[model samples]
Target chain A: MPVANMLIERRTFAKERGTDLIQSDEESPALTQEFMVANRMGIHARVAAQIVKVASRFNAEVCIAKSDVAANAKSILDVMSLFCPYGSKVFVSARGPDATEALSALAALFQTKFGEP
Target chain B: MINDRSSLTIRGIGAAPGIAIGKAFLLERGQIPVPRYRLFGEQSVAEECKRFEAAVKEAEADLETIKKSIRSEFSDHARLLEVQQMILRDPSIYDESLRYIREERTNAQLAVIKALRKAKELFSGLSNDEYAKSRIADVDAVGDRVVRILAGQSRSDLDHLREGAVIIAHDLSPADAIQLQAGRTLGIVTEIGGSFSHTSIVARSLGIPAVTGAEHAARLIAENDFIIVDGRTGVIIINPGETELEFYANRQDEIQTYLKQISRHSHLPAQTSDGHRVGAEANIEAIEEIVAAKDNGAEGIGLYRTEFFFMNRVELPDEESLYRDYHDLAELMAPSPVTIRTLDLGADKLTSWCPTLEEPNPALGLRSIRLCLHYKEIFKTQLRAMLRASAVAGNIRLMLPLISGMGEIFEARKIFREIQAELTKKRIPFDKNMPFGAMIELPSAVAMADLIAQEVDFFSIGTNDLIQYSIGIDRSNEHVAYLYEPLHPGVLRFIKQTVDAAHDAGIPVAVCGEMAGEPLYVPILLGLKINSFSMNPVALPRVKNLIRRSSMKECCRFVEKVLRMRTASEIEEAVSKMVMKKFPEEFHVFDPNWIGNTPLAAKKKSGS
Candidate 1:
């Protein structure tokens, strides 16, 4: 798939999942997605804070994992500890009601290179 | 380490020239202790997490305050603080510590340490790469701040340092070095750093005695220990004996008297004894330096470097901003011509928006006028701004830097005309005959000065680059730096040729380089009929004193004799002898050996 089309499909899927989350009251479903670190600086402290800020906006437990070490996405130290260099892929997952919304926001942030040139 | 109880002396590189004696104030980087403990209950874990969050909040607030205070003086350091604040609020750190407290039942302090250690390890793994490794220091700084806040320890504040105190540090970052108050801090001795480090530069500009690369400076010098820092000799004497103290006290008195004598001529005009008037101007980079230049009795602003406006900025400054800056400068130095040099960025100084291409020899690559020509819009905006500024305030001249040939001059003039025509159509009031000048920096420019002078209204010989290019020695390179001689016979010939060409073309020439500031070269430059001198503000009074005391006839005679010398050493010897004979007091303060060559010694030899 073209990268732009894949991004559009991902957004639509996230919106549908968010609607489903509103419909259900208890036992929120977990959502997971993998993304490549696109920024050349590779998610240093500043970029990590940016990701955490986006994740904190949603009422969900966002966690980022590289191999076996899973770090809370809402924590900058944890995201930075992931040591995700450029071209490296990490799995981003969220639990609770706003899981889909949180995952979608994070994926968009990564794709945009965190607004850096 | 040297014993603190006994007298000891250490040697380092003398970065600045002065002598200072004061009590040592040890400035050690604060370290935080992290102790491990277990949380027995849910309430304890929650309480520990709350404490950790509060500390992080305090650290973030502290960094914000620092950023605000430093923004005006040190913009680059303020940017670094922004990164630090982000690190402080990183969720990865907060969440990992929270998890450790909740899952492993550990205390908040221990959990925070573990999380920070993980990040540190990741950063250290990229130790071989300088960029990646530098990021580790930022991480550590943020981490250390949080830990210190938790421990209730205060940050190291160099801004409010006590007067007459000697600062002894392991190493000083540029931000910390800039924070050292000028009058309060007497001297600086660091354990690590070369003579050309940022800290040394700041110390020199502040006129403070500084010694760097002193082994164990922070460890050996205890707090409140009496220390003497001799910046000229790069010596640090601790717990000095009475005799040593007396000797340095006399030397300090001599330096003060010498400085006072030179400062007496600050308000005097630079004129030869034969009544030949010369202009002594200043080369300034920032707007704040204009007041200093005026205070130092500058006849006018000779070289206003425009690169400072482009540096440490995200985008290029627009026409209005550039115009306002130039207009303000011209108004401040009213009635005196302010020669503003267009953007001389690239070589050693690079901008983010317009990055120079990567090359092995950046010094000789596309830079200055070459780079400006490549980016026409950038060049046009600047010319338009300068013209607009000239409309608001008269006495503004445009100078082109690093022009190698007439081709660059013709191209620049074409753009200037276009801008002038557009501004003219708009009915803006500007000096239609605003003078344009070129800097003769390259050997090619010197060789073709006569041809280039015909096109420009004036010429300024930038000896710093001219000597480097002529000698094929980069002055910054330590191995070949010794070969960078300004008094070489070839360099003199170039200056003589360029000055003659500028005069022949009915235009004046000015030396706005390091050579103009040196007292030893004053007579030689005057002999070449180069009257105008532009240099650092601090050197104005002394150079003016030298020019004011000598006659043009005698200077010309001395230059004629020295030009006949074959080697730099021979020329230097003759100049030194002449200077010692004429200005014995000034020469004696700078060089003790000149004392033996005084007229007294000559009279004694005649009697013998």
Candidate 2:
């Protein structure tokens, strides 16, 4: 079963260069893509765990790939293994019964930057 | 055997006690390579993973014991152990170990190192805020734990530096120092640090005489040769001859005796032998220093510089918060006088509270009272706080900084009256008769002291800035720092003028500068008709000892001789020698090179 593509905000990449490691992309299919960002705070264990947990809650089968390694969207361990910093983004793809709902949720999460205020 | 000939003897500030002579062990970051994991076989890997997990648990237990041992010494630092615990329990490290053993067939140590390195990289990339920065230490702890787990050693056996051994490191993590047995450790010699570095502060707190900033300190000292470290003077002596060792032994005894003497007289007054009473006060920024001040026998807090609270945080503290801080401090120093100086900010003392201005020379630019006056709301809030605080336990005196003329004094007094009127209208329970004074730190202030004295209750000469302002030299500028002469004829003249002016108006004058508290300048300050001295708490005993040993008449004579000197160098050389000759032990130069950084300047450096 393939999920419908969800419209997402235009994502701007950070100027700083780093690795692209995806932790989650189940919510927003259009926005669930990896990026090379040099964000001040790298993708950390807590951030990775949060993204994985959020993605796991959705019905869409979210798949995140970083570098050459792709892992299930639910594994915190797999997400942290990517070693992405501020400007790195990972490739995200989700296809399932609730793909549109998953994509929309995921896009909102990326836009808000993993809930960091 | 533990006292291997290859062990090094290094000179450092001896903070703690006992002897540790051990083999040379260098804790260098370069030795540890970045670790990587690989896959080998699955069936055998499952068995190895179990062994690795068991080893990690043993190591974790050992770390807990070490944490408990230091729990008392570093009560506030127990949080460090919690971070270490999290690192040890990190799933990334455990999972990586399993993966490596199954796939790469690497040893447990290699796997652990690889896992920890990955974690370190993750934390290192985080933001600079405390939440992220704290995890960096966790990474280092993880590395330490991995080594311990692989070695199959308990934490007790980990700190196995030999007796009287000097451990050299590129830079020691605070955690490493904590794990070392305090009583057995000789000294820490690091290649990194300035005077106030974290390592230095920790060394001071631990009392583990240490000497840092030595270029290749580890490489320079070899196997067990005798060493001498003068932490007070920053002098290091290596492999001293018999006579040199004897000299140092005797010097150490003298220092011990001196410390004992100070401890005995800690509670006594700072009155000179000739019956002239000199009020010795402490300069404090944080309220925590108030405890130290009391312990060190301070009669009062002379300079409660409040700028530290406003620096780098908020634009301005609301009046309620200001009132609470001021009043709380006043209560703490109840019955004892606590002189609260208003928010003294300059371009150099830039804070988020004030907008940064373009001042070619911040030292001479709009600063101190000038900056406050320009910002009426800021100045009034502070003034109101002081007035509110005056009603509390202590006798509160308002001190204005950088007053250049009678007009400035008048303006300051006018503002004070306005605040008092507001408090009166509000019917706030505040003291109406709080004494107000001005700091005579500028040349113009000294020039118009007589006129300004009539409007103020007293005058406190801030000698550090007076020297800089009078000579038009920046004391902080290292190239021109040598020009920061406190005894310059012009500086002395200004100090004398201000002191005399206050005396003429029947008001007392006290030196609240580093000069007033120096052992060498104690006599001169007393002789110049200065009635009181205020300095950092650590300096109280030395200043008090000097005051107790000297006569005001002799001090005046010394001041007379010094005032007659033509040049700044001549005044400095003559005063230092005269005092050393008269009271060699008590009056030696506190810090020969640090002559320019006086008590007030020290506080200024911290706040500004």
Candidate 3:
């Protein structure tokens, strides 16, 4: 098969998987979670760095969205630019080969408050 | 922009001093290129990803090298590089670009460009916020580095800049400012910066001509344009005519001549014309500044802030470590008494080991001696170290910072006596009669100066905090900074009362604030009988020259005249006139237009 045709097929599969994950009736490849930004300084430089460090380890496309603004979780600048002040709820979504692993790691990081008060 | 090349002159804050006439070297703000291209197939997509990875690696390596080189000398800048490195390693940038290549059929460079633009857009929405704006600069810096690597461009090395080039830039980071070669760089004109910016501070230290807050200097002054930077008057004349060049040339020569005259008295005693003596001292933070203090003819070290030992350490400094540092300083400054102020940590500065209390207003909360008194063991450890150091070098005096009333001084005195007794019991040969002093910084201290003076040997007026507290203005707050006038009537009265009370109690008073160094305030302080003036090392020579030229009798009369003034402006007008009249040569060096003031020129209007 041509690469473009294969990409189209994969996109369709990913879309169907995303829908299934939202329905919660079938096994899905994607993981979605919400967390409060517990760190007093929120997603500042150091905390954003930590989030990116964890998200990059897995073969997952992670997206962290605060309000209507979403950023690539692996990009420190993107995560920091979200401007998720302390106590704001951050929505995390992962879709790829290792979406579950990426989601769990990120959730753990948020729970630890990025090792800050 | 002022495009009239022949006679255009711009004004800005004179951040640093010295004259420079040189060709302009306009630094273009580094704008990263965002190249977008569609990938042909899977092979092309993989190739683009590889290119992106290589660029990221190269950028990371470059930042690491820069960080390592500046680690020792410029640690703060090195730390900034650490954050940038983290940004480069961020997987989101890599993943986002990889996804773009796989799904969108775009090249790696385009993907990275798209990701950064998303970040930039987020920051742009927060343009009104200063914190967010600074963060935007950081984001741009990271993006620029990556883009430069992808474009196969090397970092712009300011180190090898051509000699005698005036640096014109939109803004310079602290790292860039530090990298500026003092000899090669003739002058600096920035589009956006302040007098207190890191760039300005570095320029001042290097004694280079600098003018910051020049709104569009980089755009107005083209590369290689003939420009004359007048640092004294904060003026920049571009493509000067022959007549203007000649005028500046003569003015530059005059300033140099005046500076040479001031340095000639570096080794002279600080005495008035009528032979009344006053001690000129230096306020130092580290031992390295001791030589500068001595070279500037400081009679003694009036304020040796001991917080240096406590900062940047994992644990509280041990007695041995503190003792060695203090002993060396005391011994080097021999016979010249070193007034070592106890640990003044808190308010703005805090230690990791110390218990952190959340204070809404840290400035008014537990700080300085208050923090020390609460943490008695820390205070005792420091006192033990100072006393031990003084044992070997007997010219050490203890000065307490942020004292509110007589009770704190009394408690401190009690602890001092106890420490002396403990040392004596252990057969330690420390100076038992080491003079103790209180910093009259708070209104309470000034109000109860007589009682406080009776307990301590001398008084050192910390006019920086005193003025801030009296005027109800935080000096750091730019909005209220204008109200932080040291010449205000209430402030002067507080100072006068403190000086008189100290004198009445048979003790001397010294001023170790920004006001003490200002030549404009010297005569008034002299009239108030301030026994000593402790200031920055650079201001010493000029201040000493002023003191030596003016008589005590004349200073008293000037002070009396100033004290009777109603407003701050009136007092300032009267003092500026008095300074020009008494020391016209020195006044010209400080401000050439001082004599042009109508109030100063009209001598017959109010003949005192």
Candidate 4:
């Protein structure tokens, strides 16, 4: 239900086709924050799904970074490939309308340990 | 046509029960071979790219449709399906496949395969994290669906599958399991899976006979090859000879007949259209029949006859063996209620164990509870085992059979409590709240129903014995057999009273004897407000369908009409009239002579 109340500030999204989506290098200041994975499962399939649900809620381009380079937070396959484990740090960066809101949602999710025991 | 094929049998796990002999419909899924072909023209390359895009779309649509049909349990896996849908749209596989198609001019199947390989390598990142394997499996699952689509052998193709064709698959996923139509899909044979796999569980739930882990089943059997899937023995015989085919065909007929020819609807819930749910449970003696019971959609084990253990053995079965049997039954039925009927043995059944303990009239002699109470040590051992199982399973219910008085109730309760205290002293676990109850079959028990209701948590009427004792006639006796009437006015009154007494005391009453399973008696029993019924598992589907079509309001009204009747034959005629009006087709299946003067052999003991 946490994702049910999500409000998008703008309707600006990528093109009709996702494969043709070229990441726009925004000159606007981007909001970035780092949080440690607290849940024992870390970023599992269910957790990755939670991240996607939160990230896709905004007009902003969400990017997640783990032990390696950042991957598209909107794409589940991309977010999962980041390989964030328990106690590992993940960096979330977004640029566009409501960038701060997206970052805040990600922060809340990480803080709650993705609702795992 | 069948002579040219190989005569072979594949051994696998019997994940379900019953028999099916039919043409094989090969559903070659989960890892299709990638076909590589070069395109000479740009037009051809573009066409191939369009094919890839369309397949991804189709696969996405398939996931969405499955998500919608996920039913009452939608939320648990709806998000997972969305995640899979996203994988279909992911840039890693989608863009890479498009790239391969445009630049390399490869076929859509080949392009999708190469792209999937690349995506898998990318998903396993820098860290050797343990989460990588399971995460990668998701990618593989999504990849497999796309590949199956590209190969034109997807699960959607199964929608057009001919009725009663046995499905042969490389493997079946939980997603595929969801789309399976129990009535249409006759049986299942998978090349790769275990007895406890999701596919097997689904097949069992649907009451479809399935054999899993049948290696090379798809390779060995071609489409339209006549085959037999024996789910009981886990044997898959491909393209049998004429003699063998005829034998298996007869075997298949026998199974359907055993189930009264309604096996297709066996998996359906016994819920009325008005949303009232009834428990369609099973009564089994042997452990192997538990599989058949579950496959037939038994909600729980209503009466587990434990006396079988003591019947055939020369001596008593040790406490350890009894504990394991009860424990396994409990664990198998986990959250479902399993009512274990304690040691219902008469002098008639103990001929193998104690030859000298025979009574001239065993039915009226010291049997069942009387025998158990007389031999207190043996009874205590069985109680201890059941209590131990109750602790582990958390769903065991103890029932004392043939209890005719409060004196016997107090004695049994005292023994049960003493064992609980002994277990508590030893620091052993058992469900202290485990319900203890009695069988409402004897005339004396029926007379004092309201008073007896206070001492017990529940009541299950054994209609067979209730009729036997109440009418003073033995069903086995040739001359007096005509008096064994289920809907006899007196018997109906007894059932009504027991149900009313239990309801007044806030306890549930169940019917587990022959009267419970008879299709003609469903509406009548439901009218009496007895919602829990335990019968032979084979009769479940037929009886459940009747329960589903009936409403509590209508059943109450019907019971009102029947209460005014004075004879069993009159009630039988009324029930026949109702069934002919409500379900005209099934009216033929019910022997209208059930309560009339034409006596049949004493209940066919095959079911129990």
Who wins the DockQ comparison? 4
Model 3 lDDT, residue B95, Cα: 61
DockQ order, best first, reads 4, 1, 3, 2
**lDDT tens digits, residue span B312-425, model 1:** 544566776677788889888888989999888774455455655677898898789998898888889999888888875578989999989999999999999988999899
* DockQ of each two-chain model: 0.19, 0.05, 0.17, 0.21
As a whole number from 0 to 100, the lDDT of residue B575 in candidate 1 is: 79
Tens digit per residue, CA lDDT, model 3, A78-115:
67767776677877878776888889999999999888
For candidate 3 chain B, the 10 contiguous residues with the lowest summed lDDT are B596-605
Candidate 1 deviant stretches above 4 angstroms: A1-117, B1-17, B21-30, B36-156, B168-178, B189-205, B210-251, B312-314, B347-358, B593-608
Q: Residue B217: error of model 3 in Å? A: 9.1
TM-score of chain A of 3: 0.74
Which candidate would rank higher by lDDT, 3 or 4? 4
CA shift of B395, model 1, Å:
2.7
Q: Put down candidate 3 lDDT per residue, B1-608, tens digits, no spaces.
A: 22243566776766777787888887654654667778897888888888888888887887776666552445545666776887666544556566777899887767877766655655676523544766666766677767767777543435436467988888887546865666778899988877656677667656688988888888789988999886645678888767557756766677779878887897799999999999899987777667668877889999998886676444566666677788888899998999999988883465466767888988898899998888888889889988998876689989999999978988888888898889999998888788899999999999999999889999999999999988889966869876878889889999999999998999999999989987878898999899999987667888999999999999998888888989887887788888878888777666554432222212221232
Candidate 4, DockQ to 2 decimals? 0.21
Instruction: Report the candidate with higher DockQ, 2 versus 3.
Output: 3
Q: Candidate 1 chain B: minimum summed lDDT over ten consecutive residues — where? A: B595-604
> What would the TM-scores of all predictions be?
0.65, 0.66, 0.60, 0.49
CA displacement after TM-score superposition, residue B520 of candidate 1 (Å): 2.4
Worst 10 residues of 2 chain B by lDDT: B14-23
TM-score, cand. 4 vs. native = 0.49
- The C-alpha RMSD in Å for every predicted model, in order, reads 9.6, 10.5, 12.1, 16.0
Residue B507 shift from truth in candidate 4, angstroms: 22
